[model samples]
Target chain A: MTMKRLINDPYDVVEEMVEGYVKAHDRYVKMCDLEEAQGRVVVAKDAGTKDKVGVVIGGGSGHEPLFIGYVGENFADGVVIGNINTSPSPDPCYAAAKAVDNGKGVIYLYGNYAGDVMNFDMGAEKADEEDDIRVETVLVTDDVVSSENIPDRRGIAGDFFVFKAAGAKAAMGADLDAVVAAASKCNDNTRSMGVAMSSATLPSKGGPIFDMEDGDMEIGMGIHGEPGVRRGKIEPADAVIDEIMDPILKDLPYEAGDEVYVLVNSLGATPVLDLHICYRRVAQILEEKGIKVHRALVGPFACSMDMAGMSVTLCKLDDELKELLDYPCDTPYFTQVK
Target chain B: MTMKRLINDPYDVVEEMVEGYVKAHDRYVKMCDLEEAQGRVVVAKDAGTKDKVGVVIGGGSGHEPLFIGYVGENFADGVVIGNINTSPSPDPCYAAAKAVDNGKGVIYLYGNYAGDVMNFDMGAEKADEEDDIRVETVLVTDDVVSSENIPDRRGIAGDFFVFKAAGAKAAMGADLDAVVAAASKCNDNTRSMGVAMSSATLPSKGGPIFDMEDGDMEIGMGIHGEPGVRRGKIEPADAVIDEIMDPILKDLPYEAGDEVYVLVNSLGATPVLDLHICYRRVAQILEEKGIKVHRALVGPFACSMDMAGMSVTLCKLDDELKELLDYPCDTPYFTQVK
Candidate 1:
């Protein structure tokens, strides 16, 4: 198959994307100038100027608007950049900590992947050892089917809500511990599952990362072509969403009368029309279950580069989580106001 | 080739999408309840309350955020939706005008397509004859390569800018004529071109609307699979952008010292990662020409279902155009603040 990507080179994709991103959104963010960080860290233009706990989020590339697109006013203070599906180096991670640290402390938020955990922990240790600055970490494990153990579950679309809650808490002048608590609380309430029709075409690989027949789909697939629960011929929109929602609703046992924020996120290439078709089913199922939807976000919030799939994320909301999720924020990708 | 879409019966795609769209974005918009309109018209919750010219935009259904997503506070007051790649019947268009009119006249804005022209004109006549309400229109023709005559060009991604400027002008208490002029002025200043890597899969057809080989790309392809200037092997991002931008910049004769807004819009399935890569080259070209970029929007602002491609739009900014474009507005797909 043709690569079918608009890129100059495989190796330079990340750097070029960053350069274009900063230039396009210069008002909200800037490239981190720290020598140790270089092209691997993006800091909000107003980072280190506010008197609040710092909020940092990061992971592999290809998930646009996940880590980098969330950096701006009242959102993430800085983001550490990684290569496509690969973790960032330790130096840039440490540099992000130093850049966003406002003397109160810094909190790291990311998905629970082994490579990312190892790298971010090293960065936190470096910050503690060098500057004696306190840093806390919150691992978002919201993908319900990734593992049987709750803490071992992988993060997916739910990372958006977890980060939003944490960012808002920090922006509201909460200290490091409070911010971490908020993120953990949101993650605990959040659940996500996805159905993938095809794998993302990696720039380096020049084609799909994995192979599947054109008319088939994998239920509960991870973002990076990780193993899913079942693979079969693509079903109707309602049937596919029904199967995906079963695990999510069952894992949380989201009972009637619960208020939740709904996110129907495109993995990559799924059209907005299909997503809403899927969201229609989700809304029908939720209405049947008597779950009140506080707000619904439908689009490509978190995506795998050019992958054909989508994920549904629900963060069951309480009063506190509601306020935090609804807090005003100005980022390149997301903006809300009073 | 497999359709690879998640949808139910092909005939119900538009109705199902509208059901989910209004449900998901109920905070900003509500389904128009006129028995004549029903699911075909979406009106802002605050429409007809503000004493200003009613702004209504409409087109086919496949473009999601174009017609429906723009209906919200300080934006298009109502949207008339149609079937995929088809125009709305005159009823919804007339209903949209009736729904948004508040003593002040209504102005219809949309791409300049033959079917749209005939149907909207009929809607305007119906409103005048029945309700004694006046409605004016400014058809957008910004697709630079669509025709040699500027007035006959097709509108594509540049519709976003024209609608934004007119919406803000109307919200600022401009009369119908002023709003129409605003849209026309923005359209005159805007130019766009695109390349397509694949054709969008039509729900009704259960396959691509047109055939495109795996690795071939067509420069300046219209959103609905219209033929472009050239078809050949896909080139590097910079080279492809160079080809697309040449006609846009030269046709406008954009000169040094001109300030303009930039939009690198994804044509459905193109990833955000690839768009910024393309934007990097756009910036480079603008810098070389000494053109100043006021602001840049890079995303899937306008799409063609699941077609894999992108378009670049440039709207030259004067003091008036800049003020209008920068005006605060909140919609589901696009939002800005003072």
Candidate 2:
């Protein structure tokens, strides 16, 4: 029997974890607008504070400390979450913005995806119409592969780069336009691509979300358990990095004069050793490309619950962008340079 | 063909991880003690004030934020770490005391095991004779499993509980003897027992140092990867809880009138889902026993580094014990209730 348990049916599991994660980490609660309804779980940094520039970012729940985890001082102002991969409803996003905004405005920044765009856009539009609170959004479409063919690229793991880059500028008294510009600049300079070995099993689905032979893994797997660009057999860390980084390096095509920030993200169960091995090769590869890596990070920045694989992100940077990129933020999943 | 590459040399993994864990969690580095060694790692926290009672705890390198991880304000005054399961060297312990001591003597409180006892004793003897700081030692002989008949009633996961209770007493400026008495009392009241699905992979060993079948799990496993009291096929969450809770409850033999503090600790790699599932059952089991669980914590409190198992600890409580138990602590691995 393919063993599995529906997480929703076991409502206690999510509730218990949310309560514990919050208690262990920090205080986070649903935005008043979405608290009554079951859609968005908007969380504010200072629930005690009346209003501020509501900075909201969220997605599916599993990649914890990601969407919800990172909402704290010098980080996100609020977070609005939905089921894993799905988008939160209009009410929650609107609720989150209103709760944090002190008539200044709200910035809804998240990965670019159809679902999130629909709901968050709806939320933003509704906020303007219903409450007259100005809401602006900067869709972070940073994925090299998905965005390559489409006019507007899809957002991937690199969204946090933008979130932090903009989050710091915003938290440090940047106005709504400047904050939006900073977030969009991050979106322009950033590109992320990932791969997976062994499909991840969602809490609701006991079986692997997709099938891959023991000897094979898929490249370009989506963070939401979506299919990847292609499949390949087991390979050495160097060889795998070649597969992941070459496409990224080529697509972004950093010139010899360019400087970039590198992030090696794990998709859940890919061991840290593998992350290091991959990064070790990446350092060499970038050096070979004669591209100066100003800074790099290797960790489970964006994960697919228990998925086993890794991703690489490169953010093209200049002097102005570099300082903002180096800005500090403390989120549950991602901690920026401190 | 289990293929892997070390994040560092297999030899340096433990020490490197420790260094990394400490840097990431620097808040635990205490008031001052940074200059102990010319190029030495910062001795996290020192024994309160030398004049006040000092509580020192130590053990292996891996389990981050544990023995070493818990040494900070509201926590252990200092930590003496061993290489893996090996106890801390006498030199470090002696140095740690001298660094932390103000005028009063230091008290060495650690798990009861031959290695820890011998080394800690040596350090204590040397510190008392040489340094102006007085040094005393107390052994936590809690495990109901290990008995005199079994060569030693060894200390194990239950050390943290006893430490917290004792550390709180010491923090209140208790005298050395009083701190030792309080710590000893906590140890006597506390008991822990765990089950492991597999043995931990020693850094030197490329593979797991011990073995269990694919579907088999052992009951009553120790955090040190020591053989458990029993081994068996996988059990349901309820069955797992029953096996774990029965021994802990039986060992302590709690009375209907007794109130208690409970902890559900993940060895490592066990998801929060499993932790919460186990915690839920643990709370249920305690309720059925008519034992009031006054305080509860469920997380990777005391882990065995990537070992997939959990241990349950219960400290039968009274008013005095409860007050100490409720004291606040900020350590890498634990944040206690105020």
Candidate 3:
């Protein structure tokens, strides 16, 4: 199929998208004006006003609402943006730390990806050496099947849980180390797996990043088109959810009498109708296992721009995680109130 | 491409989706227990609790967040759901009125579609005859190119604005007549136009509802595969926005000094990255016209399942409209807080 995106000059997608984003959501965010981070860093309007530890989360650009949309009151304070499916350069990462630092400290949070790790580490070093601003990092690794070694697994939709916990913790005036521990705890309890029916179309490439037969699906696929554990004909929502849920349930060993926060997230192009159908199955499975659902969020929280698929993330909750997850937040794409 | 939806039986999609929706958002909504509307009427958990005019909105099933997701505190008190792309039967409509109505009265709001108009009218009549409860309605007609006469036009993305204004007004303890007036005023001031790059696939048919070359687009397309004004090769985002914005601006004749609320909505498959890109052009054009944007919402507020398209809706705001639009509400899909 021909790539049919509503964009101008494929090469300019990221720059143009950033321009539009800040304009549309001007009340929530503004472009960071540091010379080195002109179009790459988005800072919340209230970023440096509070004495709380600043929360900075970022990664590639295609996943809208992940890094950028979450930057607002009581959420992520700043974001370092990159090109589609690519890590932000070191300068923007460093610039983000500078822009949001409130003299207390700043915590950097994002998915586990090699490029991201290298670039963010460099940014952290610059903050320490040049500016004397303390910064901490917590890598999210929640895609259970990506690696048997949990620390090496790729972060997917579970990034939302970790970021929310950390953001709320920071907003509550937790010190840098306490905030990092809160984020690390959320990451440790979260598990995610996804099934992709089609690959997302790349703007610069002007085609899908990968090819799959129209009726096929890849189970446990990574967000950036990384290989999955299995690829075959599309199955019913229940069958697919069962397949994905088995690994997540077993890996976390989420037992009966345990409570969890459930997220049935659309990767991108999947309709809300389909996501709810999938959510129904997930709820039924949880009920069968006697696992309690504390709260459930269903929609596109994180996306792989225009990819046709969905992912399920379950965060096993203790009292602290539950309180943090339910904390009031206001953002362009997410909002909660007492 | 084959239709790759993650669903069980196509016929059971609506039932299962409702089952999932009520489970996932149980904090805000519940299944209406009227036997006549079982599985069809979704009622807000707080419905009829306050002595204010009841707000009810709904249409078909495919537009996920449109009718269902908007049911919660200070939004629609109840929703009458239908099968995919089909209007609700009169029974469910009457059931919604009965479920939500306080002693004050009830108001019905939905997009302007012939089927919806006929059925909701019948429902209102039934409510008056059988229950002696007063009911009023304000139909939203915002698609600029749907007809020469404004009231005859179909409602598309502009449904969100009209619904919001009415929901807020009713929640502020307005009577039925005042709520209807607020919704009517919003519908009158709103204008919208859309371009579709691909047809939405229908689950029952197991194929695209209509066919077009992958790289082509139709300007001013309706949500449910209705005919659009022009069909040709797809163009850049700016060019397409120009075509859509011209008609909306001319139809509403939004003046240089007017302040408006803008919604750049994805039909379904369009990415958020593209929507913001579209919003940037919309903002640029409005700036050139000297029309100030009061606020902007860019996302899939309404959709045609899996259709690759977007629409821009502009609601010229008066002080009254502005105040009502900004009123706080909490629903599963949309939330705004002071």
Task: Give all candidates' CA lDDT scores.
Answer: 0.92, 0.67, 0.92
Residue runs of model 3 more than 4 Å from their true location after superposition: none
Chain B TM-score by candidate, in order shown: 0.99, 0.90, 0.99
lDDT digits (tens) for residues B225-292 of candidate 3: 89999999989999999999998888866668899999999998899999999999999999999999
Candidate 2 structure quality by residue, lDDT tens digits, A31-77 = 34445335445465573264346687876566644676567766687
Cα lDDT for residue A125, model 1? Answer: 95
What's the TM-score of each model vs. the native?
0.99, 0.71, 0.99
Q: What is the lDDT of residue A23 in candidate 2?
A: 41
Give the winner by DockQ: 3
Higher-scoring candidate on lDDT, 2 or 3: 3
Please provide, for model 2 over B1-338, each residue's C-alpha lDDT reduced to its tens digit, 9 standing for 90 to 100: 13222244655554554444443344456333334322222355444443467677776665543676567666677776667667777777777777667676777777777787887787777778887578877676666555633226666667778888877887888887888788878887888777777566565775676766755687876678766677777666667878778767777567776898877766654544456567667776776878886766655566665566777788888888888887866554455433
Interface RMSD of each: 0.8, 6.2, 0.7
In model 1, the clashing pairs are: none
Task: Please estimate how well model 3 matches the true structure, expressed as its whole-model Cα lDDT.
Answer: 0.92
For each of the candidates, what fraction of the native contacts does it recover? 0.72, 0.06, 0.79
DockQ of 2: 0.13
